[model samples]
Target: MAREVDPKKTRKALRRLKRARKKIEDSEKSDTLSDWEDEFLGSVEDRLETFGSAFNDPEKGHLDEALSGLQTAKLREIERKAAGKARKPMSRGKGFKSSFKRKGSGPRVRDINEDIEEETPEADEIPEAAAEPSRPSGPPKLRVVKGDKGDT
Candidate 1:
C-alpha cells in the first residue's frame, strides 16, 4: 500500500519552493549574481518532483541529501567559471596594440642642428678676437753666436 502525503509536510515543501524562486529572482537583480542561487532553485525543484512522484515520507530524506551535494558542486562550478572569465583580459594583455613602427617606414627625421643652435650663446655676446692671446705674426728670429776668443 502507498503511503499518504502529510498536509503539513506538503505545505512546508510548497513554501520552501516559493521562497527559493523568490531568492533566485532577487539574486539576479541589478548588479550581483549569487553563485548558489541557481543551485538552490534546481535543488528545490528536484525535491518537489521527488516528493510528488514517490508519494512516500522516507524519500524526502534521500532528496534532501542529493540536493545538498548537487548544490555544493554547482556553487563551486560557478565560482570556477567566474574566475576564468575574470582572468581572461588580464592574461590576454587587454587588447594592447604594439606601438613599434614597422621596418622600411624610414628613420625619424628631426632638425638636430636647430636644437643645438638654440642652446648656443650668440656670437656678439662672446668677446672679440682682440681679447685672445696675441700670436707672433712671423717666424721667430734666430740668435747670433758670440765667440769668447774673438775668433773670426
Candidate 2:
C-alpha cells in the first residue's frame, strides 16, 4: 500500500522553498551568497521536488515536516544575513564577566584568612547569659484536654 502524504505540506514546502530562493537570488544581485548557502538552497529545492520532503530520516525531523527545526533556523539566519541584520551573540552564562561589565566590577568573595584576621569586637560586648540559649527548667507540662465526643 502507498503511504498517505498531505498535499498541503507539499505545497507549503514548495512555496517556502521558492520564496527563500527568490530572496537569495535578489540578495545575490546586491550581496554575495557563500558557496555553502547557494549549495544548500539548491540541494533542498532538489530534494523537495524529487522526494516530496527534504529529509526522510525521522531523527532529523518529523516524518510530515519538509524542513527540520534546525534547517528552518539556519534558513531564517541566512535570510537575516541577506537582509543585512546582525546575528545575535551567544551568552557566556553565569560565573563569568558579561560583555558590558567592567573587569573586577562584579561582587567578589573575600578570602577565608581575611575574615579570620579581622576580629569583631561585638563578640566580647555580648553578656554570657544572652549569648547562650536559655535551658528548659523541667519536663513540659501535660494537659488532659477533652475533644468533642460527638464523633465517637
Each model's lDDT = 0.50, 0.73
Candidate 1 segments whose C-alpha is farther than 4 A from its true place: 28-152
lDDT of 1 by residue, 8-85 (tens): 655555555555455445553433345465655565556556654222345344432323344434444444433333
| Window of ten residues with lowest summed lDDT in model 2 | 1-10
Q: Which candidate number has the best TM-score?
A: 2
Q: Model 2: which residue pairs collide?
A: none
lDDT of 2 by residue, 41-90 (tens): 78887877777777766787776777777777777777777676788887
> Which 10-residue window in model 1 sums to the lowest lDDT?
81-90
* Count of backbone clashes, every candidate in sequence: 0, 0
All candidates: CA RMSD (Å) = 21.3, 10.2
Q: If candidate 2 were superposed on the true structure by all CA atoms, what would the RMSD be?
A: 10.2
Clash count in backbone of candidate 1: 0
